[model samples]
Target: MTTISRFTGARFLPMVPALRRAADRVPERARLPVAVGLLCEAVLLLWWLAFYPGLMSFDTVTYVWQVTTGHWRSDHSVAYDVLVWLSLQITGGLAALTFLQTVALAASLGYVCHGLRALGVRGRWAAAAPLAVVLVPSTGTFGIFVWKDSAYAIAAVLAFGACAHLAARQRPLLHWWLLAAAMTGLSVFRNNSYPAVAVAGLVLLAAMPRRWRRIAAATLVPTALALALNFGVYPAIGVQKPSTSSYYAFNYADISVAYHRAPQTFRRSDLAVMSQVAPLAHWSAGGSNCSWVDPLMAPPFDRPAAERLNGKLLDTWGHVLAKRPDLMLSAHLCRGRIAWALPRNDSDIFIQPPVVPADRFGYSRPGGLMDHSRFLPALRTDPPSDGLHSAGVWAYTAARTPELTWFLWTGSLWCWATYLIVLRMMRRRPLRSALALAATTAGLQVAVLVATPAGLFRYMAAPVLLGFLALPLLTAAHPADRLPGADPARRGRARAAARPQSAPPRSGAAA
Candidate 1:
């Protein structure tokens, strides 16, 4: 005879009581952090178990090859490759790396949730904000996926969330260092992320009211670290560079589209330069596929020859862009459509079946490319159990659902939304500090648009994750009052410290 409303209010999950009891033991001000920590860690544990060694793809296999073979390259994220190496050494597999990514993400979002709570958001909802951000189909699936973009998204969230936390109240120097680490780590995990993190640091400098010298130093951390690692440390340590031809992949698209649409558009000399890239057939055939430039630059494409003729290719592409702007621009836009306008791009990068492909790890199955003995003893895949199967089904369907695809799966939408929100929040002076978060997302969007070889869903992940985390910040409420049993002196000072920060400080004011 119990009503549905009663069940809605009921704590049916056994873990709820334990989490509540644990939170109750902490001081009132510290309760949210403790709860968030416990919740994030607990959920990640279950999520990791279901996927076991964690999700992997061709890129992961490459990383594994590097680790197992002892040959390393800087084409991919070398720092991230080292992380994979460490995880493999510790767990003898990739599970630990996935765990690190998910936990770090949950921890970062928890910081932002706590900041929202401090800003007077409702207690339960603000505490649950990180849970929502991490548990979404796209994000939850990515949690187990072994990709640098996943870690890149986590670092972006950390940098963004840390900025929100620092802005919420008077924070210690430790908090600034936290932001510094997140910003620096952002680029280290993704080769193309330096520009985004660099701009984000500038956003930090502008948003912060004081501490110019210290803030400037923190701002330069990513720039300095990125440059030193790329130019000095990498070469010093013997990290071989990947094919330089890949660096200019996008140029292939420009030249291909021009030759494809009109063979006569190019002069004899231009045609000669074009052939140096790939055969005319590769260009014409690859033109039909604009999602990526890989087809145009595929096997038998003479990569070293292309590298030598880089100047000629650049000239050809530049000529195409100048003379046949329509074709070139359309091709570029089509290539990067996922970065600008993929509302229905439900293709979450979760390694869909989460099974080992037939062509990897000393195994071969139907439809697999081939088999290799690389991951023999170190890594293997699990047969999808009922729970894992159900979860995969959920992730797949939830991604395709039209209702969620536009908002959750499509990242470009979030990027545009973040910019719009930043513009609106600028009118509310006290909320301007949040622009630092918006700027980081915006910068990432720019990076993907300009540099990404393909418009993959993973490129837009940061904005998607941040969009969900930003929801609780919209709540309007008073800050939680101090409980009677808490330390009165400490609570009083905490409230006092928080009150002054409510008013936006003028530029050049002390921290």
Candidate 2:
């Protein structure tokens, strides 16, 4: 061969061999983490290419305002706002935020993969598990979206992984710390997660005697810290207390119940407070629980007035429910179905070329861009490419289809299913600790049912993601046998030797 040919051959020849050798060097057990990490990087790249800096919703804009102005809002998590502020300071835009989220998600899922391998899943099966999770539309697609829900989901998975590790090994100080950190993130990232962490912590304390002290500390520390930050520290630092409209957690339920069951539930005096923004007829004619409270009655009430009215309305709500329990229950279930049963949520959740209108919430479009420009310059000029934008539209469209929609919509059902299945599985095997962790994670959906107003998929993303990821752990054949430091090869050989053999292969050649 000529010198040029030799050079070309030398360059090209090692590429395949190099890949094979690299693949061989990666232990079978480590393949799953590597694969998950690569998938996460790919996802981050696709999102960056598609949305450039990042996608934003109305909430995202609000968060930016809060972070930039130092005017904290109780309606949103201060912890999350602080996170965004700090991240923006370092990376200068949503790019860094999204990048960190992708890393978090990859690490969380990799931990799940580690747990699966530790639970006796074959290396190949464990490697394939994360791919399955990634294929689930609600999981992989919504995961990359820029929202507090994304962080909560990552935290939830990390907590689950920590629980699985503790369940299997029942030792290791690192796992305890990991659980605490994960729980802290899970609890603080979203307000609704507070109760879920509380419930899980209680479960851990009650069920996990071996690690109850550590678990209790893990659970309580985060819970207390979250409460302090949200209630005490935030206000001390000049963060506005959440307005009464935001405080009355069950406003939607109260309005829906009153509209449907007791149209006369709200006194004329109470209606007078709401009438500043919406007519009594509007509250009475409420078809949707959300419509009755949001953009209408609730917006009219300022902080102090809202606080008084909410107190009165809550009492009235109680009386209405007492008189018509059946109707009230039905209304609650109906509203919850919107959150838990509907496959597609509001149209704007993942909108491409995000519609930040000029007059939205007192911030003009240009002003908004200028405001965010300090951290995100690409927001002004880099609209998503046509191909990636189209791909996003297509993916979302596919998610809305009947089959895939079920995964997205039925997250609550899956959580319940996981809880029930874990309970049953625990009875037959040594999965008490892991099962308890999963059950608590699944129980988070119940909290969503109680606390959330409308069924938004983002609200339940963490629980749904956790339930799906827990399947391998819940169904492992020999969970205890696969604890850390146990020898998989030795176990495999032992199983092979124990199997009955009809005859030896000694006579194969002669016979």
Candidate 3:
């Protein structure tokens, strides 16, 4: 009876040999990269099919307009506009553009796994790392979104991952080139990234060892070029200066701080200048944060009027900050909490289709605002398939729940954690190179805290995504092995001992 049962089971399990054969075809070293690539492709396809074409916010509309027309505005990064224009030229639609973005994201993540493998992580854990990334709600969902923030976040991840790889490997020329390219993309993708990269470069310069000093130049040079392009080259070509009103956006916290702490300090003349854009009555009602006096809500003033008020706006803000530095600091802390503090904030910048005038988009579906026709033909004019859309919505909703939102929103916290972990590890070994990379990421988070207009989730995306991607690198073992001057003889012995010997090494043999 036992022999008969065994024969029956063998006959039924016909796929066992084929499964083993297929698994055997993938080399052990290649498995992680292969799994990561396939997972990335699957996610991209799923995102495309569900949201088909792509998802967009108001910023997406503005960017598309800027690209379609030659008119350049400083409100949006012309550098990013150029990328969008290039994508449009190549794919003639958003699908291909998103597909390219997916590839970049996957490649950046694969670099992380590669760095981990180099740092002595087991192959199985390295391969499984991508799964953790995909399962993390914020990390995977942002890969599908079509915003400059999304592009900037992806570029930032690549730049950091490349830096990590360079830090962990002895042969770093290739990684250096990769880091340079990624940093260049990062610098151009967002206006705010300039300062972040600059800060990171400084951190790298200060933290890296003497031998790795050249890598500092890699971060600084690209950042300088990006600054030249944004400030010098764009105007040389034909881009118009960004609106003066845009500068006022930075003064929201200032205005709020003044109003809340010392409303009497604001001279009547100061109020008059501000009234040119926002209604002083409404502003007074709104008080010391963006909720009352958002620069976006400020009415557009003609050039002469705007220029005159812009001068006053700057002068008044400077006076307020100078006179009441403490209040300014308090306001910044209060507003920045939404971005840096844990437990998440209520601001959601991921609103799809956007909320504009109903007539603007021609659609009458309940709350539809902008006309769907204004978008490129490639973008889906109607909603996606119900099943796919529903599933995406459900997942997104789940991700947004308070418990998960805390993790999703605390990207800055993650950077600080990375910095602390790297700093701790450096005490016992030569990990300054990796420490520099992690510090750069932390610096970017600090930049967001200092410079972001409000605590919007989108503003924190890059730091959040980067912090998660840097995990394997931060938590890796054998920190000394990846250092620049570690003894090769000792490393060889360690590796030999780590592997199982076939027999006791036959006394006199090479082993």
Candidate 4:
């Protein structure tokens, strides 16, 4: 007569043995699959390094210069610079530097694989599919390239792995603090990453209350100090450069604005043209809005560098919030759009010439090229294949390569959907979910070619890694029936239930 619930309650502690036995049944050598997967990934990394030898598109040159020169001491992305410097010192060539990056990424991927295995995802075969899907896409391209994106991806995987371990194990305050510091360092390394760290920290706080405030405070203090060192103390000491007030004139702003005007269909084409022209126009228009000015754009003698930057960052936020609140919201909302933009399958640089067949003649269409409404048709046909490829080129074609256009369109849509899901989820658990949401959103803001509009998929790499780490946690299986603790009263009731009713016993005896 023992009820199922009663039996379950008595077996709680003993279930551990059952679970272990189950785990043991999962083949001792299952790790071989993961090892092989890593090997394949390593091969891909090596091949890309050998063949591409550093694709000449987007931030490739600028980042190389930053590491080689070691100028921007307070420029935030210090870790990546340090890694690059270390590579240059050791190997003595940019190719060597790229190899170093690939190795770092491999290490990060290894850690991620370990984390997945720890979560009961047995065998490499089980892990390979998800890992391949994420590692490929635009992310794969970044893995092989030596860029901030690669470094960010590496640091992010490490940080997130650390965080997931800390969270899953319910570790001590000290452990959480250590992970927070590591995350802070990574965030500082990439300017766009700071907001993401802030957001993610808040999300972690939402989930664990015992040490939530302590964890959040620990994270914020170090981050604030890092910001001080980068924008404030460093500039004051002349270790870093100061800023100027000319950002509005920068072409990125104009491009962002242009995107605001365009419908979602051809945002990639719009961003492509803007990426080429915006910064120059911003520079020509005269001001320090371009990120390059962070080191060289010194503050006037009237105020301390830290104070000046604090004021500027504050003012920038204030202006955006006050004058363009809607734009700010739109930007965050646009994270969804940015996330799903399709891969424009076009070459990152103008290396390969236009390959359209003569039958695809609509590509040669003219007129209405400048208009947003005509933009999609133009992008579909013209394929701007080699038209205005380099950063140095002056003339703007307004036409986008068809493949590139489709990629952006697809990437934008995917980003938007994820953004909305994150947003909706965060509303209920603000502290815990906000960071994931923000990281997903803001990370996309920089990831897509639209906001920062870098060609390499590396820009959005942080969120990409985060999404990977989040997968296991999201799909964790619920214990069908969590065994309850043994209770004497419940045992007594079950014993009583085991006895037959007295009336029935009497009737049987009479018969």
Which lDDT tens digits does candidate 3 get at residues 356-422?
3333233324454333434545444223587977776677667776656666656657767666667
Residue 76, model 4: lDDT of 35
Task: Quote the lDDT for 37 in model 1.
Answer: 64
CA RMSD, predictions in order:
9.3, 4.5, 7.0, 16.7
Name the 10 consecutive residues with the lowest summed lDDT in model 2: 347-356
Clashes in predicted model 3: 4
291-336: candidate 2 lDDT, tens digit per residue? 1234333433344555656666676567667766766777666556
TM-score, each model? 0.82, 0.82, 0.80, 0.53
Model 1 lDDT per residue over 345-462, tens place: 4332222445655466433344332334445444455524768656765665656566666766777787777666555545544555656657577668767776777656777877
Looking at model 2, residue 282 earns an lDDT score of 53
Q: Which stretch of 10 consecutive residues in model 4 shows the poorest summed lDDT?
A: 374-383
Instruction: Pick the lDDT winner.
Output: 1
Candidates in descending lDDT order = 1, 2, 3, 4
List clashing residue pairs in candidate 2: 339-455
Pairs of colliding residues, candidate 3: 256-288, 360-371, 361-370, 361-371
Candidate 4 C-alpha lDDT tens digits along 1-511: 4797788877797899997787677554444434544664665453443333433232443344545554555433655656656755665544555555566555555555554443333344335633653344344445545556566666665565555445334355654564665566566666555565665565556545565676567567757866776767666754555243332222223223323433232234433433333332332232222222222223221123324344443444444455556654454333323344444344321221112223222322343212332212211212133332231122112223355434322334434544554444435333342233233334334434333423333455455445544444333222221123312213335546666877544565686
Which of 3 and 4 is the better model by lDDT?
3
The global Cα lDDT (0 to 1) of model 2 is 0.65
